[model samples]
Target: MASGNVSSVTEFILLGLTEQPELQLPLFFIFLGVYVITMLGNLGLLILIGLNPHLHTPMYFFLFNLSFVDLCYSSAITPRMLISFVKENVISYGECMTQLYFFCFFVIDECYLLTAMAIDRYVAICKPLLYRVTMSNQMCFMLIMGTYMMGSSGAIAHTVCMLRLTFCDGNIIDHFMCDGPPLFQLSCTSTNVNKVVVFTIVGINVLVSSVTIFISYTSIISTILQISSTKGRSKAFSTCSFHIIAVSLFFGSAAFMYLKPSSTGSVNQDKVSTVFYTIMGPMMNPFIYSLRNKDVHVALHKALKKRMFF
Candidate 1:
């Protein structure tokens, strides 16, 4: 029992986004504003989707999930960070793991959900009449459930692997939140197991989602080329462009931060790049989807009008 005792590290001091005292307040306000926008944007999108019956397709079903993910994702980190900026920047071990768990869950779920959304678009655009039949209510529900399960599996694997690693001395995490990469870096024990598990889980996530999006888009392009009307082609492209941009931002930054060995970059650089996916990506998601898509705009307007009249 004595030999197997895990060394206790109760609290971790976050090095935070920056070291400069002068920059701290400014950055705090900036991130605070970003968090506010993320919350409102995502919440607004959720309300819009739920209120408008017309937007109740598989596409908006996934978008609703995405809005939920964004809200949870931002809430997992931003509030704590705002507090830390004003005074203390410490997190208990249990709290850290909890944050890491949900953060991983939402983010990884987005990868799968986004892929599912792409496939939905592919079915809608390419298959047309078969869209309703192929992407039935049951099928959509199953897909959402499957995506959540996949996300939970990855988060559980990484967090469990992290639990095995001993953290004896240093308790500083050099990032805004409790993420896998930074947490793994602080372990006193050899992190080979954690690394292997993370790599395996993340690799499968990135690879499978990438391939799915690729196949979806490839077929989508083929379908578009067959359409003779320029207006029809443009409309189809517009509908997908927002999703493509969101995917590129989320996956591209995620790949850059996690796909490579940790030794290649400084902790500071790593923290900054992580901001893109963890923070900026969530902030941008609802904005990208809602602001750019006409259907979403229409839905938003109808919902607002009903609220105003009622």
Candidate 2:
């Protein structure tokens, strides 16, 4: 029954964040601005990383990919969401699934990419002598490949499970996007197995990535403590502090959206959480990295100067 299942509902109406008549226009403009900034920020970062020879290290390599993922991640959800703020927000089944798959793919990619960055930091600080050996160009390429592999596998599994279920519960999604939980709730068929598998995979992605980051930071802190110069310690901590902030913001929203019990949070709260991770996360990341990183700032200044002269 699961394998042969076909959707009875061909489209879904997204209820959006607020049903109030007055709030719709304001919200649409706000998210449109967000989407615009997200595009500029990520694109600018990508250009900065690509053009600068000094930034061609393992850390910037990860940041480059991170910016790219954030670009795709926001693009996958924000435009459709902005549309919902202004109109009836109808999405066909195929479009919904496509959005969901890309959303899941980029999100999972970010999770493991952050984990890989943490490992890079760990090696950079804890084993400075072996940093080059440990995170070589080939090694970095492989880690990035592994991140995408995980992302593809995770998204495929979730989308496949959703594909096997038929939706029949009035076709109104109470959230702004085509997320897994709302779709699961809309399914008329038994979703016991789907829920179990989906939740299990979510747990694995969040837990494994977070735990790896924690352990890496723990070792990094320990290493930083042993450094004799306070200046050196503070410099090391500053680099890590920004990454920590970005990780916290992203994972904090993710936890609220996915890990909590369904009975505890309102649909509106879920909408807000989804907005943060999907829109705000991407928009804020470029600022977080570029503002905090001296290397990025210097590269941007140089790029600006060259363009100014040319």
Candidate 3:
């Protein structure tokens, strides 16, 4: 591939999740349902938290932002993904970059936001006396803002680096979405800088967030164990249980997808891993939080009953 050819390339074909004709329609329907659930569940949770005065606490405030991030995260990839299943999956270079940018933004935002939520839980459980003072409204707002800023900065770094690489090779992207690893594989120019930048930024982001969550939960669990009553321990564990489940799913899938050596992993494997976080994670988060959470269940029931009475 010549430099001129690379410079002239304006679009790329997405190979999508699979090449089998028989699987496309089935996968399409499956992801379509996932997208719909993700949207409705996250949006409903957002509205519920906003309208219910009882939920106006630091915990629910973090949850509200989580719902918002899930909504955007799923939207960024799923809609384009659905189109690929039914039609041609050609994406212009610019559109692909845009998709990658937003995808990175929301995914990173969710990472740090989950960390912040864990810290909130830590304060609530481990330092109950200081919870209110530590996680004040202004403080919560700053935490949320910081997560978004971190996400944006990482996204910009990745996109800007990607824009520098030339793509003269075959324009076929092996995966469904414009992901960094797959995109790097297609670059005609040296992707050493892009790879290093991605690894560094992602490493710092995931490491900081994961370590924070781990430390926070360690303190939280220790504090829970100190509670004398079985009921007290169960209640405290229950509060963080849903968060633990969500964080595991989000971070576990993400780490497997991004942190692994790209050469050692097959594209098919990558697709499956990506599906877990990108499609399934968002779809399941609202249910994970709501079904396991007694307060959310109570608030939902109350809201429904109020609506029925009206």
Candidate 4:
């Protein structure tokens, strides 16, 4: 046991989604396309929000932050995964840890941010009279700050705990990225404490965010139902529909990936689930918000027309 605890591996080889040689190039092109779309879509949205004075509101403010987070989040994992497709998929121990930390940070940030967005929607829809006062500029800034702080604290906690564990097991990481569960499997030291910390932090983040969203939407739905006109109700629902879809896709895929018991046979399934949230989610968010949003479409058209005219 002591021998096993002695450090021998300095780097780990990532198996990267599949061991099939034939599939590697195809998956590479697929994810490269996804990454390209993720960058363009999110960046375009950010630029649109920044330039359009009409979009300078509390909702787009939160969206600006969301797009930034999604950009950073996807960059943290996707670039490295892309590299794995073409090169020898080896990552240094320190590099892997850094990747894990940022991945956790952005993911947790997103969870809380989505909750904040839900709260924003609730205040706007359910308490329109108080929306201006309740979601003032200072208040929105503080909420965004708090989300980052919570995410940083959680990431720090997980990374610090993981650092204490010694990894002397074989140097192959089964998944494409250096995630908690797969990394834990490589640790030769007792991982009970690490597991406990992970479960506690993740459970709290997911639970609190999920509950907040649930309560906010409950109020939002009730308020919408009270509207006397069908058109009014539809209008109200449309306002939150994009957010609802984004939240459902993010949480559903994440819950499927992290909440399940770790099993050796499920690595491929885990990879697929991870791709949904980390890769596909970011790619889809800008489309989800912009395609359904009239304001975004209007702003985009005005911007394009201005560019063409200039």
TM-score of each: 0.95, 0.96, 0.97, 0.96
* lDDT score for candidate 3 against the true structure: 0.90
Clashing residue pairs in candidate 1 (N, C-alpha, C atoms within 3 angstroms): none
lDDT of 4 by residue, 91-184 (tens): 9989999999999999999999999999999999999999989999999999999999999999999999989988887889998898988889
RMSD (CA, Å), each prediction:
2.2, 2.5, 1.6, 2.0
- lDDT of all predictions: 0.87, 0.91, 0.90, 0.91
Model 1, 140: alpha-carbon shift in Å? Answer: 0.3
Candidate 2 has a TM-score of: 0.96
Instruction: Report how far off residue 122 is in candidate 1 (Å).
Output: 0.8
Clash pairs detected, candidate 2? none
Q: Tens digits of per-residue lDDT for model 1 on 98-174?
A: 98898889889989999999999999999999999999999999999999999898889878888887787478887
lDDT of 4 at 65: 95
Residues 54-125, candidate 3: write the lDDT tens digits: 999999998999999999999989988888889889999889999999999999999999999999999999
Give the runs in model 4 whose Cα sits over 4 Å from its true position.
Answer: 1-5, 263-265
Off by over 4 Å in 3: 1-7
